[model samples]
Target: MDPAPSLPPSYEEPAYRVFLDSLDYLPPTDVERIKSAFAFSAKAHAHQKRMSGEPYITHPLAVAGAVVEWRMDADAVCAALLHDTMEDTGATKQELAEKFGKPVAELVDGLSKLDKMEFASYQEAQAENFRKMLMAMARDLRVVLIKLADRQHNVQTMSAMRVDKRVRIARETLEIYAPIALRLGLNKLYRDLQDTSFRLIHPHRAEVLSKALKAARGNRAELLGRIQDGICDKLAHAGLKADVFGREKSLYSIFRKMKDKHLSFSQVLDIYGFRVVVDNVPTCYLALGALHALYKPVPGKFKDYIAIPKANGYQSLHTTLIGPYGTPVEVQIRTREMHNVAQEGVAAHWLYKDDGESSADLQIKTHKWLQSLLEMQSSDSAEFFENVKIDLFPDEVYVFTPKGKILAMPSGATAVDFAYAVHTDVGNHCSAARINHELAPLRTELKNGDLVEIVTSPKATPNPVWLSYVKTGRARSKIRHFLRTTQNEESARLGERLLRQELLSLGVVPISIPGEAWDALVKAGGQQSLEEVYTDIGLGKRLPSVVARRLLAREDIQADKAQHMTLAIHGNEGMAIQLARCCQPIPGDPIIGSIRKGSGMVIHTHDCPSIRKSRSSEPQKWIDVEWEPEDGKLFDLRIRIEVKNTRGVLAQVSGAIAEAGSNIEHVSMDADPERLFTLLRFTIQVANRTHLAAVMRGLRHIPEVTRITRERGGEA
Candidate 1:
């Protein structure tokens, strides 16, 4: 309790000496093993010293001390002691493996930087680090946890180091580690790290931000106190046993609130709030109802998560109520269990994992994602890291199926993501949707409590256009994989066409070419036969024009194939239209595309309301293009509108879009009724790009329109 009595005067590995005594749990053998690891690391780092003039062993020992605070195991403790031995001390992996066991050495290796490996850019190096971490995370999540612990300690002492070094490390921690912590559900660590990093990286802004929050909070103190007291009184009056604890938004949460919602510190409601923890789930709703009676309930600010747990298993009943002071303050009603889940997130699973049978079920039901990472390792490290970042965002939505089944997805997830989430087969064959009984597109963004019904067919396939509209990385990645496969099929088709043209150019039809000539041609091309040649061309490694030239010279084909395979058929090289997915340009959203010649297509939300509002007029380069299909070609679109949150708000919005004959693809919302505002971003589809502009017009006609915008280029 007294912090393991700091390093003894005789301590050579002072850091480890201190750590060994501090941990609450550890066997005697484990202690000696850790100490020995510490000694070896010290010897390896003998030449190094800290900015504070302490031996380098102090750093590893310090890191190990922090790991002890997390109640980490013996192996983790030992690895913490030797974490930098391989990185800065020039200790070989073989040497560490021979000295420590393979596991300890492997952990040290994972903690080691890839500074030795050359990369194309510093960004590449950072990206690889993130990628390696995802792979490591999939294997042993403890590795990154240990790394984060190490980083937290390093950051605490960074002030003693160079200013430039402090800023660099802090910025990386802010951008990367903080996000990782949140993604992994290490809420306390994540928040603390973000604050610390903010302090170091942008100290002035952090200071100004801190002061602004304090001033605003100070103004609300009396009102918030009354609300807290009122909640306590209501709980007492109802004879419900509960603990009502006042919780203010953290500084980082406050900063994010201001930045994200474009609100001044004073303007942000729900900054002052209280959480009432009851004994059971039933009591949570009872408390919510009581609070609503006590204060006029703010419309559309209510969320019932007890019936619908978050992707991370957080459950609560949240509502904003207009209080005695005429200001709307939020009250979160949850059972103690729910409160724990809300704060600890996945770590809360450890409480359930304690019981043998429950632990198995917990792992089974909860860790489907952990298993997915292993499957995801088929991707490269950077790609894997990108996936991790995508998956780690904390906001999520819960929607119901017609049969009463619930699906938990990230906040921005579209129907496309939902399809892939349900099953790869379902995603591939998704043809239509019914949200609470109306047809919707695969890109539909679902809201909490919507009864979503996905319609599938054997005929339909994953639309490549869904990539633009899909929000979740899982859906995006799956759509990409399908598209890649589709591209291969297209390429193979084109390749065959080119081959026939080459034969024609030589004035030799495939049937007319004699067996001897074909065989000679195959041999000259260093291939097995004509099939191999064709396959290579299909795979894109072989050039059809080159093959045609060789065939002409050797009399295999004529020179005219060059003109037949003419890729230059489109004379005026225009930037082809490729749709941006942020707002799919279905008949419902604005659409634009800037041609990047040579690149087939690029798309943007038509007159992105955000951009249109940001700029006075549409820019000159907003080129127009239509969906080129003979029939309807699905166009993904994003439609964002500020609407009043009320009963059937989502259904009404979806209904309006459905009335326009477009399908809802994906939808998301950031709303607090206390502010009389909710930001809803939606993705849907129509016959072509033309349908999107009409959708925006329709959204504007909706009564709740504070603003509606599409994601387009030029403004952002």
Candidate 2:
């Protein structure tokens, strides 16, 4: 047979051929169509290559193969093949539609990126990328499934790259892809992606910890095998027909368990577990009972998901057991239908033709919450992307409404997020919540199946503090939206207060800043229409100084006798004080304490903006205030030097400052990058303006110095 004609040894072929041969599970035509799609993709990506040495076609094939295992429709298979061709192969939408059909073309284009010209920032770019992915997911949920498959393949192969690139890929996988997969209920893929990325992202810890896991699995091998067989034997003895299987927990799940519960490796006892699947729900209970009798069950570790399924449609009876030799073991019992739903999630109905009331439509209705993301559109891509991230976050707590309807909510969600998820109006008008027949605060954390009642009144409105308490995106976003609408009210009050304060400082009547003039000033500011003036005022863009300056030349406005607020040597000209060298003053900063000395009442920013805010915005603080003709000798300010020293460094620094303009009073050197690192600091004389700037420029040009900034002393 020539050894099967010596295959090309494709990376994906071995795993994929298994799926291809499962033809009885799929109609022959559908299977052939999938193969043709793969062949087409191979040609399109024939010459293309990934960062890894594999043919780029292998990625899409692998993605399609994953979807096939899910038993998705032909359109999904075709879409997976053409997913990246539009973006990377210059393949037009028209060509895709003509060749593969309209649904496939639409999915491909939806997954494509926005043109580079549209983005202004990395945030905007990310948002656009998410928008594209979301649009794809909304149209064909299979798009996300395939995308996740691609991400999984990439993460699995991330180690075949450079160190920095590996970290970057792992980070993206952790931050974006893993969260999305988990949100879509692909637990197995999500776990693999997370664990694979974590291993690379923190390799050293992963290795040592992985070694411990291997040792523990080895040591507990006998106990786990006994527990598995014991459960199978007991179920058989009870006449309950079932299949039992055992597996260990993923490293990522273990790591997360450790981090969240503050448990050490040994403390995690539920790592190795077995699952039992019977033919029906009644049998599932029978199996559970059988297992319980076989081994003593652990306390407070049982869950009945069959009665109330997980948010992802996973239904099982979970019970921890104390097996032979005191080894703690876990067991899960579920019916065959429940097992399929648990493993395949929403896609299971499509594959198995679940006998229920429009299972596909029910799945869609159940996932309307996810679909609502596309409907609640935002003009700013960045905000929209952020909302998607918040929306897709996994790890949720399920609770019941007062009417007994189950509401799945994000972990740490309050009653507020629940109310909003039910209806926007209910959330906006929410006044209070009751948990388990007791009055609970709106911030009360909800647990599984707590009957929550939301109280609403006609006068109820979202409060600003709700933003702090609400954990879900819907509540936070709705609250922010409502507040933004009411900013007009905030604007008028804030503007009036600021105007009044400015009038008091100028010793003038507030009425002199006429409302008509205020309207005109607002109109000229290029804000959204007119009333936004007040919103801008509330948002702090309308400065009092600017308003004062605008109303300065008014006939009724009076000017106050205020000092120039200059600084100089203690007791020099006009009894004035110089601005403190240690601190600079800006309009938004507080001013304090008059000094009759070096300069009279030297002006200083009450709260220094330097440490609190970046210096970028306050160039005006670089002042012209001078030392009054020296009534007292100059005070020394520490100057820092950063440079390369090769002998004569101190002499060169002192000479440079003197040559450009000032006198050096003292010199000091500090330990830097290393003991031998070059850095020389000198207290130089800048009697005034010309001398100060000259010395600075001279010091700046010195070859060795890295950076020089003013260092503050103890006093103001």
Model 2 quality (TM-score): 0.68
Ten consecutive residues with minimal summed lDDT in candidate 2?
A: 567-576
lDDT of 1 by residue, 1-716 (tens): 01122333536444444665686477876776776776677667878888878777778877887677666677888888888877787888888777667887778778888989998877668878766665665566567778888888788777788889899889888777886666555677788898888788878888998887777778777777777888899889998889988776767777777899898867764456778889987888788778878989888888877776555455678898887757777778887666655665444554333424422333354456666644444345566556656776677887776667788788878877777777878888889988878888667788877777788999788766786777766776676677665654544454565567656645557676567766776899898667667656655467665676566466344344423322211111122223454444443333454423223334545555444542345343233434333454555545667788666777778888888788887888897849577878776766654566666677677786767765544222
Candidate 2 Cα errors over 4 Å, as ranges: 1-43, 115-120, 269-272, 354-362, 372-394, 492-525, 543-716
Per-candidate TM-scores read 0.70, 0.68
| C-alpha positional error of residue 304 in candidate 2 after TM-score superposition, expressed in Å | 1.4
Misplaced by over 4 Å in model 1 are 1-18, 50-54, 92-100, 160-172, 214-221, 279-286, 335-341, 348-366, 373-384, 507-543, 551-716
Best by TM-score: 1
